[model samples]
Target: MDMNASPVPKAVVVGAGPVGCLSAIALANLGWHVTVYERRSDLRAGTHHLLAPNTENNPRQRSINLTLSARGIAAVQAIDSALVERLLHNAVPLRGRMVHHLEGNTTRQQYDRGGHCLYSIERGLLNLILLKAAAVVKNIDIQFRHKVQSVDFNKNTLHLCNLVSGQELDDHFDLCIGADGSHSVIRHHLMLATQMEYSQHYLSHEYVEIRLPQGVDSSGHEAYLLDPDHLHVWPRGSFTVVAMPNKNKTFTSALFAPKSLFDTLQYPDTLIPFFKTHFPDLLSLLGEKRLVLELQSNPRSQLITTKANPYHKGAVIIIGDAAHSMVPFYGQGLNCALEDVRILSILLRKEKDGHDPSVILRVLNHYSETRHEDLVAICDLAMDSHLKMRHSVATWSYMIRAFIDNILYAISESPSLVDLSETIFGPQVPSWSWLPLYSMVSFRPDISYSAAKKKAERQERLIDSLGVAVGTLGLGYIIYSFINLNRLF
Candidate 1:
């Protein structure tokens, strides 16, 4: 250590989840000393089944695997490209969704025409990877099992309790980041300090996890029963069963339905009959004995959507689920959380000269105001996606619209039809400018959530008008032909 070295600024990140771990790495890279405080013990020391529910500590253990897309990759790549590569190396890439119909037939729908894929990675695995990365950073110090009791933004202090030793202490920081999660202590403190508006909504639907183990192939070798390249879905109007591939030859599946429906199927008699009626095809995959066992064993977790306005107060700011926790329908919950760190880092990088009290507050306020719009857009999109996954994906109109959108996108991406593409879908000034809504939201990291929603609205309106015009022309032709046939008769 040089005697003439300038004192490094310190930042405290609450929660050692993926978002908090990434936040710490980003801050450390920005020449700040970071201390990551996590309430849970080091997960890397635990077994692969880290998502096992613990009703005593965490009732809603996130068992659903996360879909890592461009937004998340961009964030990680911004800090360290090597880290992104390592994460994806362990993740399973999914290109499309295989929809299982009532008649035991299946149809696959590609997410994008450009062959972009969503990486399916377990939440614990992702957090573990990031935790390892954070561990290697020289300036980052991770203290697990140190729960934050309260926060005082006014004094820039945190009251932390050591769960292991039963000791309590106060820690001060130049900056405090609240990445604690949906139930955030720092967020509660900020709410008390500032007149921040916050709202949390629990959806009527709940989900329980199920497992699909590997099966033997013709060669007698273990293999995936379903196509591992695509997400499998059994959409039944009001409820759905979906599965994402794991690195192993197996898959983690979930059944989502209304609370009322879940209650009715609590017993084996009702549950087995219900599965036979609605999800008969899936029943074959998950045998009667195992389905009942898993369904009964796994805790049914509620889906929650949280919204908070002005996610910052003073030198403290909240990110990820702490700020906005959306349902996992769109699979953007984790992606958006990762993007929060990227956006915040960019804003902070702009103020490179110095971060005084006022300057930090100013930057935080701007981030809160601008980022809120994008967060709201994604939260609403996630809710809408839930309905689509549960009901609309099985409809003809949905399939037709998806087909048209993909065709338009493929035409736009073709090198030979540059001029034609430009005419049909606006100017091709920016790459992926003519992408469909899903492509823009999932594959194009450059487009913000709010911007994607706006563009999708415009595209939808145009498609609706074109449909009406085509229908009118077809009706006119039929009427004319009918009149001519009557005259001949």
Candidate 2:
């Protein structure tokens, strides 16, 4: 039985977001018949169609800009380097974070040494590009405005409703993938089919969007009011505001605060003063009138962290936010989701060589087993980062430790030092090769999230021991100097 002569498996992908589109492209590349179903109309039809104007009644139109790191870029590149390059052309590279403090004081924290950067891109635009790429594939079919109402995993059939024509339809496939985000219909049916462990936890904080229009520089050319090369953050003790630049020269900003805070600022009188007291520097960039309008108009969206075990069962598999929806602090949610497609694609390709369609069950099981730990690791990291971004970024101790970690990273990168260390300390010191937690998570595509977390824990312990040793030596030296001075006197 030659597997090469076997017919390609038909795959149904729910949702037309970036993850779904990427999955379709990957499946098509792997010689699968792919069909993508999207509930919303095609977004690439008109200019600013996705970017709905800030209205008094509706506010959840456009999402915060996506920060694309090495993990995501690697995933896209794996599918098509040309597609990745096209996406990068519209991205604004962000090297680090610019922390804005009270009294107009600002501090810059670089994410990595040696010029590593993350790209900021409009989410809608990126989705459009991905959909376009998927559309061109001969083996892929994209159906817009078709909502999946229910799924029967045992039967391998989908109950879908056409939003445009108001017609219900049934679609059958060899495999059904749910990338329909946190509230997924496929995930719901999977829960009914099997005992799937799932949990959704929401943070007390909620966020609202604020748009910062482009301004003119001294030369009368368009320029960014804030540093365009860095993600701008105004971190308050209990809340924070972040802004990311777009190619259109505007910055999409979000104000994250407690629900109680949002409740109090329902009117202009309270909202205007709140911004004045907490984020005074933003007044010039986002004028008082515009800020008030956006605040009053924009909906306050909650921050949620969702986790599910056994992302696949039978012929139905869940990926992206449907599997593990996380807070956006670590900026790895989308990256991890994209990586899911890449990994699953690899597994399916490997299984296809067996020429047995039943091998998909084993492949999906393997995927769920292996991908769970990394998903959990990243979810934990994202939750922890909320505190680090809002409060820890302002502390001197955090900065000092970051500096020390970076120095060690620089040393590890030196070929001579690495060679000498390997010769002296041998394999025992291989684990000591300095890689900061941020670098491991954001910059290194080779390391899995779980492995990175474990390595970080070990490095943290080493740093703690080194800190204690250095403190003790300083104290001993001071005591010796004092004793000698007393004898002289």
**Model 2 agreement with the true structure over 127-202: per-residue lDDT tens digits:** 8899888999999999987988888777888899998899999998888889988888878888888899999999
The C-alpha stretches of model 1 lying farther than 4 A from their native spots are 1-4, 48-62, 413-433
- Model 1, 230: alpha-carbon shift in Å? 0.4
lDDT over C-alpha atoms for residue 256 of model 1: 96
- Every model's TM-score: 0.93, 0.92
Model 1: per-residue Cα lDDT over 192-265, one tens digit each: 88888999999999999988889889999999989999999999988999999989878989999999999998
Clash-forming residue pairs, model 1: none
In model 2, which range of ten residues has the least summed lDDT? Answer: 417-426
In order, the Cα lDDT scores of the candidates are: 0.85, 0.84
